[model samples]
Target: MTWTLVTIPASHYCDKARWALDRAGLAYIEDGHMPILHWRAARRHKGTRTVPILVHDQGIAADSTDILHVIDAHVAADQQLFPAEPALRARVAAWEERFDRQLGPAARRLVYFHLLQDPALTTDVVGSGAPRHERVIFRGLFPLLAGLMRRGMNITPAKSAQSREKLQALFADVGAELADGRRYLCGDRFTAADLTFAALASPVLLPDGHPVIRTAWARVPPAMQAEITAFRETPAGEFALRLYREERRASGL
Candidate 1:
């Protein structure tokens, strides 16, 4: 059966799911939606209020990690996101959890905090790939949408600052891990940990050729651009970018 993956298009979490499905060579249709409208679409599918939901003949996956498992089941053993070795699989899972909880939210809040400052940038990046009507609605209701997003995500100057600190600490940790010259997070082979980190870091890294539209590096605020430049120089950030260049092209996700 053809899988239908619902997403906000620019969401890092959705990209994670899309990458895994593509890596596993699963044929699927992507139904991209705008922000608030995505909640309704998600609810219609499984009474859940989140994107990156995957629907197939067997059942529906309401989360990105769940979608990874579904893709794993459908693909050959070598194509699995989870490692075959028990210890390596456990390590991959642990890293995925940490990045999912810390990296994803912090990067999202930090990026939105800056992007919301420019209505045009917000519309151009977030509304890209959405239906024309949805894009129009986003432009018309930008104020309300921005307000709701700020409130829901608790985006404030102080919170954004805190998120930047969190991101720095996480990147430092990843950098230290890579210092030993390990090719991948878990071991020699690429696994979900690498995929999760790279995908979730897209907001800050603005990875080239990402499936979603991204703000130009030059357009980012001066301070934010400085930080992004520093991040791009870090070992962890370079690793993420390399994954995008090599693995993403291989998967064609």
Candidate 2:
């Protein structure tokens, strides 16, 4: 059997896996979930319910970063993903953790809180077979995307604020880094760090006409929307934007 990458369509975490695998030029069968039936199979074995689980020849690689690292080792010759320098590699790895765990959650919350309000988008997601629905769509399956979105974050006010602050501060640093006018996150080349930041930050600075959501998140007001745009214009966000367009098009995804 081919090694399979189980992912959820439009999931940022899933995008993380795809981004890594694509950059490494690794060939793996991708299983994208909308009904999420394969995810149930993963839960049965992996003992956790998460998308983007990789079933490699060795074993089940559960985490996005873990999967990336595993594939990366095999393709170590590919210098585009991770930096060749030890110090740069360390810094890039650290940024991956911070972005995935910190900025990821805050942006998720900021978007989810608002997404639940958009009637059209909500209907679309529910129609995507999200296991359940809150009210009207409870016509058949489960209920509430909110519950699904909220899971794993364990977000309290304190934690949420902390993540938000860290995300803002970290992005500020990234902005400063890009102010020197580098093409990618680390140097003139695209790295895993760039992919992580761009993919994770999409909710805050959503790509125009994204097919999945297909609309501006209703939660973000015009003022904050402006802030998001400004952030996108920042050196860091600009890099992210360019990467999204360039890499995405180059891959023909």
Candidate 3:
């Protein structure tokens, strides 16, 4: 059966789902959509108002983490995101959950606080890979949508500063975990923990050649770029980027 992955192409969580599908060597069609407009598709597809909904033969996986579990079920043991050993799996799950709950939102708010200020640039970033009509709609109605996003995500200057502080603390913790010369987040080999961290961190780290990074970096604000540089210098940031460089692969869909 041909799977269909619904996504807002520029979204980090969507990228996380894509990476999971790719790692599983599962072929699927990417149904890309715009941000606010994606609700229609998500609702029609029987998912919550979120991207990265994987529609498969059996049913739909409504969340990125759910998609990973779905992909893990079909792949070989070695390719699974969750380890077979109970202890290792628990550790991996803990790290993945922490990154999802903390790192993901913080990175998103910090990045959007800057990107939403420049509608044209934000349009380019969010509209890329969307259908032409959706892109046009997004560009035309960006102001209203941007306002909704800011309000919804609380993307104020104060909130953005708070997100930065949160990231600093989280990254420090991740760095300290790596102080023992461990290669990956949970252990020696890659797991859901590493994937979640890298994908969530992509917003701030902007590792080269990421689907979202391609259109964003060229036009990133100077202040954001400087912040990104600082992130890249951190041990955790370096680890995420390294995973992107070495582990990220084409979906082949």
Candidate 4:
């Protein structure tokens, strides 16, 4: 069977999976949809109600990171997404976990606070306030849109300040780590850790031709955009940008 990537358009989760598939030179169909459609597709697989699920001949791989793990194992060539250096690879993997779980929330909140763009999709998924027609079509899919929205936006001023400060600290660490001349996050070779960090962190350090970069970051004011874009031009952000250029989107980016 052919491989397919089921995901929400412009989702950083989806972007991470895409980065892996693209880097591996793997061919797959991309099933792009809004928040509601994502849940509908998740039921077809086992153990997944999230985007970036990969369905290939070897049954279905749920979870974005899990999907990438499977891809690294099954690809024809022994192309490594992890560093060959064992200690460094382990450290990078630890960083990837934190970035995916912790820093990800803060960074997402920063974008939402600055943009105020919360398209609350939970109701649409769970059949709360959505149209009757949508409920019928959606069936059992419970959308996580609201949770995503809550993570994406900080409505109260206090919350926004807290999230922004957290992100500022995160960025400083990332910048400091890249203060030296390492091209990739794990120091030279393209690895899963870098891909995870780059996709989630892309809001601040966006590269060329990414769909979300324009909508997410551009929503900010001109002066602020300029400031953030310049920061992205730094060694850390530049490292993420180069990874997207040379590895993630080698075909187009």
Give TM per candidate: 0.95, 0.77, 0.97, 0.75
Q: Is candidate 1 or candidate 4 better by lDDT?
A: 1
* Rank by lDDT (best first): 3, 1, 2, 4
Candidate 2: Cα lDDT at 236: 69
Higher-lDDT candidate of 1 and 3: 3
What would the per-residue lDDT of candidate 3 be over residues 20-120, giving only the tens digit for each residue?
88877788999988898999999989858988899998899998899999999998898789999999999999999998899989999999998988888
Please report, as a residue range, the 10-residue window in candidate 3 with the lowest summed lDDT: 209-218
Give the top-scoring candidate (lDDT). 3
lDDT of every model, 2 decimals: 0.87, 0.65, 0.89, 0.64
Query: After best superposition, candidate 2 residue 175: deviation in angstroms?
Result: 0.3
Clashes of 4: 0
Candidate 2, superposed: residue stretches over 4 Å from native: 34-39, 123-145, 151-165, 208-227, 249-253
Candidate 4 lDDT, 143-163, residue by residue in tens: 354345554444455776676
TM-score of model number 4: 0.75
lDDT of 2 by residue, 144-167 (tens): 444554564544556555655666
Worst 10 residues of 2 by lDDT: 126-135
